[model samples]
Target: LDWSFRTTTRAAQKLPENVEEILTEAALREAHLIRKYDIPAALRVNTDQTQTVYQQGTNTTWNKKGDRQVPAVGIDEKRAFTLVPSISASGELLPFQAIYHGATPASCPDRKSPFYTEAEQLGFRLEPSKSDTYWSTMAMMKSLVDDVIAPYFECKKNELGIEDPDNQYSIWKIDCWSVHKSKEFLSWMRTTHPKILVIFVPGNCT
Candidate 1:
């Protein structure tokens, strides 16, 4: 028997039985909704948040083939922040929000800093989480909608000559995170902005 040493690879997270079915169903449903509403690509938006570390020195290690143990480093400092980016189906990049994790507002960059000024000029927000985790809270989600999503939609509605913002139908795609899927969040969205339809991408489907 001959075996060659190789780098270990990350294992698949999900082994669902019907992955094809799941994805096909999701696509079909989304298409149906878009077609039914005749929503333009400008108003259809998809957004996602990702955590990034200040130092990403090492992500891989030499390992034998078929081994699951892959020791890695560069994350011991545990300093990280969450960045949310959004884009429309028409290829319009929307303003995103950056959430800094800290116990207080002091976590935010100095107002006088160039980074702060650049962020402001670019229409992006750099806000503190006011908590231990960079994960979005109900309040943070609200801010995201009010500051980034709502404004973008409003501009698009105006450009489309839609007089009633309340009647401007659109779709928003987000992951099924706990904060986004909570009853309170859904209720708030329905009550405050019924025109914006929220859809959750099935977790771990890709």
Candidate 2:
């Protein structure tokens, strides 16, 4: 569950002193469980959420040599959102969710936009935070599990000829974020999804 960052700048993140030991044990346990349940490659999913901006541009520009002053187009980093992307070990890319920064449904872009239409046709989703931050909320987490995660498992199960996909043993790897580790969330998953084993990536590992 190491996040894949595209930016070149190195983040000042830290890791535990016993990271190697932790990773070794986790890896061993994961391998054992995967083999034990005969989990399909399509069911081993790793997902992550990242803060993203609306426009992608650079502040650097080629200017006159030794110019007294120079300026570059600014990137509107303020218009930010959260992107949740998931992928399976079988190299299948699931439809990602985009949580726009807003407190109401109106805050999101118009559904009539051609871009939105195309994205929707591809099973993409555009959600409103309905909160101060664009980060994923408890409700959003549920939506992600129900709308994207569960359906994906069901589809894979069908392909694997599983008679009971809802109860099939699978693995979902994610970071130990607060919302994800919440007692309520865990209970909901236990009660609603008896299977779909949740695994946490050691904090600050990468």
Q: Per-residue error at 22 for model 2, in Å?
A: 1.8
lDDT of 1 by residue, 72-174 (tens): 7773557888889999999999888889987666797778886777779889888889876887888889999989898899889889887676676899999
Clash pairs of candidate 1? none
Number of colliding residue pairs in model 2: 0
Per-residue CA lDDT of candidate 2, range 1-206, in tens? 89874545556778888999999998998899899988989999999999887776665667999997777555445677899999999999999998987877787779887688788877887899987889988989889999999889988899999877666798999898999999999899888877889988888786
Q: Candidate 2 lDDT (Cα, whole model)?
A: 0.86
Model 2 alpha-carbon drift over 4 Å, by segment: 1-11, 56-71, 163-166
Number of the top-ranking candidate, with lDDT as the measure: 2
Any idea how many clashes model 1 has? 0
- For model 1, what is the C-alpha lDDT against the true structure? 0.85
